[model samples]
Target: MITSSPPFFVPMNVGHAVVTGGSIEIVGRLAGQWFLRANFTSQLARDAATSLDVIYVPRRQANLELSYEWAPGSAMTGIVTYVGDRFADAANTSLVPGYLLVGLNATWALGEGYSFQAGINNVFDVTYQESLGFPEPGRTVFMAVTKTF
Candidate 1:
């Protein structure tokens, strides 16, 4: 005779979750040709079933930018970004460290609906991982020309 037992595991949504957060931003022109923009965010996320922090939800983040207008229709800008640590799994057992990145870019208008832009990302080539076993990109450079009608 053969006998079968019940399933060992079942997947179902048994509860609900709640999330709350707030963010603030500021943008303004500084002395001379300089400009400033900045923002920050903070949040709390929890899983109802386990009463634990939500997976992959960053609790804090921020960005700041400073720019200078050197010539007519031309500007150079520097950027800084930050991300807070977060969990990679629903159980909150795996943690991914936060990271910061810096970048710089320039834009020049060529007149008559034409423009040129270039930038580099991850200026210091900092190594980071947003998830387990997956690595983020290193220093990257990009350029572009756009024509608007």
Candidate 2:
């Protein structure tokens, strides 16, 4: 959707778009319960093109989250991602935009309503920018713990 009015001139933008492909899931339980779900996704972007310049970005990615929960205070999870050809190119970069990244997350219940969680981004410590020229954190370890009354 594109809308323009008087007073202010908003050149051109991607407007809004969403593109998705599909995925498959395989699950089972024996002695303990486990769940694995995957998703295949793509992006639909609008690159403002005028009489002078033309730009467009097409992003393709696939991600998966495999996790298992056993004891009350123990849960482990692994995240994996894969990018298409475009993302592998040096010109294509970004943690969110078009790039290849992998991360992991884990949680602990703490047994008494108190739980702790942690995650590490850029698992391989791969140095990459999120928005082309912008700098993004590398091999970061983020942790947060919470308790309920």
Candidate 3:
């Protein structure tokens, strides 16, 4: 009778989970703009002790995005994140600490149908954990361009 959790786990033991998120955007004149966004979660681990339960984790916990285009050919965008830890540790793999990530993005219309966008993530590149025993990527830059059809 090798029972996991001694048949007594949490009221709801959500197993390892992975959440995906992203956004789409369009810039117009007069501080006009459009955007599309979405996010989702991975799977849940129902069996731990009996299984590996090494994929336990939690959701981002918190997220935020802000933008301002008060001048012509210029725009500024900002984002914040609070990621929850998702590691392997039986009972609840989602027992990692949370963290905050601040970012700022700017864009300038270089020409018609052509614009330049530059941004920074974790500008501080603060070290954090991506997993239980692994470190997440450090602060990085995000740049891009657009040309409508």
Judged by TM-score relative to the true structure, which candidate is superior, 1 or 2?
A: 1
Each candidate's lDDT (Cα)? 0.82, 0.57, 0.57
* Steric clash pairs (candidate 2): 94-130
Candidate 3: Cα lDDT at 130? 54
lDDT of 3 by residue, 73-120 (tens): 677877766666654445443455667778888988877778889989
Candidates' RMSD to native: 7.5, 6.9, 8.9
Off by over 4 Å in 2: 1-31, 46-58, 83-98
Model with the higher lDDT, candidate 1 or 3 = 1
In model 3, which residue pairs have backbone atoms overlapping below 3 Å?
Answer: 16-55, 16-56, 56-93, 57-86, 57-94, 125-139
Best by TM-score: 1
What are the runs in model 1 whose C-alpha is more than 4 Å off? 1-15
lDDT of 3: 0.57
TM, every model: 0.85, 0.60, 0.54
